[model samples]
Target: MNHRQSGSMDSVTIAFELMRLELGAEVDNLNAYGASLFHESQYEEATKLGERGKALRGFLEKVQLLEAEWVNSFAGTAEVDYQDPAVEAATRQILSNSKSPKTALLVRYPCGEVVAEKKGADTLIEVIKRAGAERVAKLGILVNSENIVSRTPSKKYNEARVPPHFIKTHSSTAQKKRNIEQISDALGLGLTVEIIS
Candidate 1:
């Protein structure tokens, strides 16, 4: 869908959540309220509410279909498999087994400040700039507030540190891949999604 449709969907999603929280499973109350309005001679408002109920039901069906599609997308993940000799060797070394194995993300980051390279520097340079910004935010080195890295250190701000529990929780290869991609994108880290076995 286009950006406008996507934004409108997001608004509808929020509205759906809010309505769920307030009304719970009593969604039939909307129709009841519309009936009450009709009895009170407010035909226009009742018609509007009835039309809105229909629209809400339609949106819910669309959301359910999207959810089903997303779930089905993970059914065949063999497409992510890469059968390179180097990757196989690495996988064998990591797992110590050639029969069954799992894939892990290998991230490579610059030791210190990232300096621009002369050739093919566009993407790397942009990543470097983002990495610098991320580091600054993490350290709070140039901040005007009291939550600096020196005192009241928070794990949330540490871009370089990936929580072990997060990796453990996201056990699926696809989930791990997405998580690593998000981390790599957020921190501008170089990553190799060594799709093994």
Candidate 2:
């Protein structure tokens, strides 16, 4: 389907379409094979085939859950339509298990910047590496203030030298700051990193 048409469809429809396109055929094939095995009285083989079918169903369920979460999170506040090419691409990436840094998902801001949801320290880094400096500079990055909270202790400070809370909060903040700086340096286009709540 064209990008525009795909976006026009509601989230549930899109999820079903993706399942039909990507998994429906495999499911049908498995069921057919399993049925044949059952007819032949090959109980073990049929059971194995059923197991495979169950695994595929589990995968589909995961996709559906992720789609629902995505829809819930972005359906209302999104700047660009959910059916935009960028959002579609990101959805495909997520479904295909190609999402870099795992936790991040792509989101487009009102100013026409496509950024990944702030995840870990490597979220922006992965985006930069995947799209490259120029492309990423154009797309931009959004960093959440909450994600900047320090979670790891600094190497320079021991538990005895500072409170654990200080290490987690202050050190994590420093690490996030360094991550942003590194991302800026890698992009080399005076890349502006938008800090959001």
Candidate 3:
């Protein structure tokens, strides 16, 4: 199998490939019907395609997880080809889940040198304060909009209903900016905050 970067293939393409690999002779017929239903915007039939795609993805993830467990259990002596496309894809998926926040506070010195990079508002503020407010010139807070927007179900509830406030308070862009602004005010530093989608 040819190993390609995660960015090289979209979710749909990956799903198709997985189905072809696992289902063998049945993939062509199934894909043809799925494509027809999707193009016609047939929600009922299209749902089946979506479910199948999700199942394939889940299967791939599970296989990867099992492979990882086996390798770990046998110690570091297992001869595994990390270059295989399936292994690479699975590893990428696992790593993507564990990725650090792209959002960071860039601390710069008076001489226009970036002295430190810290993730999260609280830690960044603490570090800057410790570095001494007089030595720092400008502060840049980078926010990734995708991370700020909540995709998971909110646990907090208001009057028997899940309120939007739960998500907003935890990760909304507006809330993050407000927190950063407050930090800037406290530290008496010039703030350059950018929200990237």
User: Which candidate number would show the highest TM-score if scored against the true structure?
Assistant: 2
Worst 10 residues of 1 by lDDT: 162-171
Report how far residue 195 has shifted in candidate 2, in Å.
52
* Tens-digit lDDT string for candidate 3 (1-197): 22233233333333433332343213223444565687788978878886885575566547545544543464234333233568556844643333223443344434565433343344344443554433322333212112221324333211111223112223322234444555456566555543222
How does model 3 fare in lDDT? 0.40
lDDT of 1: 0.39
Candidate 1, residues 77-127, lDDT tens digits: the string is: 223233345643553343322122222223345554432232211222243
Each candidate: what lDDT? 0.39, 0.45, 0.40
The residue ranges of model 1 lying beyond 4 angstroms of the native Cα positions read 1-27, 75-197
Total clashes for model 2: 2
Candidate 2: tens digits of C-alpha lDDT, residues 36-115? 68888999999999999889867755765665566666543444333356765676555444212212223333356666
Q: What is the TM-score of each candidate against the true structure?
A: 0.25, 0.32, 0.25
Residue 171 local lDDT, model 3: 30
Candidate 1 TM-score over all chains jointly: 0.25
Residue 2's lDDT in candidate 2: 51
